[model samples]
Target: MAARAMHVLTSRVGEHNAVILSQEALSNLVGCSERRLRDAVKLLAAENWIEIRRIGGRGTVNAYVINDRVAWAGARDGRRYSLFSATVIAVDDEQPDANELGQQAPLRQLPTMYPGEGQLPSGEGLDPPSQPSLGGLETDLPARRISPPAGSPFDDEK
Candidate 1:
């Protein structure tokens, strides 16, 4: 559950990089009570799994900084990491037919082939071609666009 909460925090970094997690947020993420969450956080802090930061005038808020080193070290010590091995037989790049290439050379040496614009030769669907726009403006639209009038809601009238 602690690992799951860490994953959630990591995922949220993309949307809210500056987000500071509240005890309630962490409790909800870990499916535990706020007190339990606080205890878990304390344990993690003692182990250098995370760093706690105090915020605001009275230190009413706290933030957690995940320690990747501790997490990866634990994983490595537990033998949870894996190694995969495989052998490539053959590959073709120029022609769509795989058989065109003699099945001798290793597949890793073959140049990668990607689908181009429009449909394939067999009429199968393909991604449409993308055209670059002139500064994101339509070709038929006016070159210069109008700007919004400048004024704040708090502007003073003398």
Candidate 2:
């Protein structure tokens, strides 16, 4: 569910490379309750996968930047942070208040996978994985080209 929410948010990082959306809308897009989304987002922010920039105040639209940890890590490694880099990035170490995070039990840590560590046959990252269908199921169906139907209503415009 967290990954799904991440995908929905990261996908919006199109040409601009950064996206801003309300938490409510983002939760709806990921098909999860806002509570679940908030918990998942806090975990992701802690792991440095995404950055939620504070806007007005609490419960507001914060700038969602993907691939932020990569940049922060690069800086620590003596490399300048470039928005054009293909590497994933991080954000500032600022976190929300503990009360906002709730008094949930500590989450178990998962093994980290760096570049060249876990390579798929197609060489893809795991966190922001590109799953086209259910549960990463790959289909062998031939690709189809989409085209508009024969003109009817808009034909008069020509």
Which candidate number has the best TM-score?
A: 2
Judged by whole-model lDDT over C-alpha atoms, candidate 1 comes out at: 0.51
Q: Estimate the TM-score of every prediction.
A: 0.36, 0.42
Model 2, 1-158: lDDT tens per residue? 77987888777676654566667767777899988988888888888887766545685455666764324335646654434322222222223553555567789556454554343333344453434445556555667865545685545444
Taking every candidate in turn, the Cα RMSD to the unseen true structure, in Å, is: 22.5, 21.7
The prediction achieving the highest lDDT against the true structure is 2
Q: For model 1, how does the per-residue alpha-carbon lDDT over 1-158 read when each residue is reduced to its tens digit?
A: 55665665566545322235556655676798877777776776687766656545554345555533212223665655422221111223324775655665565333323353232333335532344344656346446754444575554532
lDDT by candidate, in order shown: 0.51, 0.62
What is the alpha-carbon lDDT for the whole of candidate 2?
Answer: 0.62
C-alpha root-mean-square deviation, candidate 2: 21.7
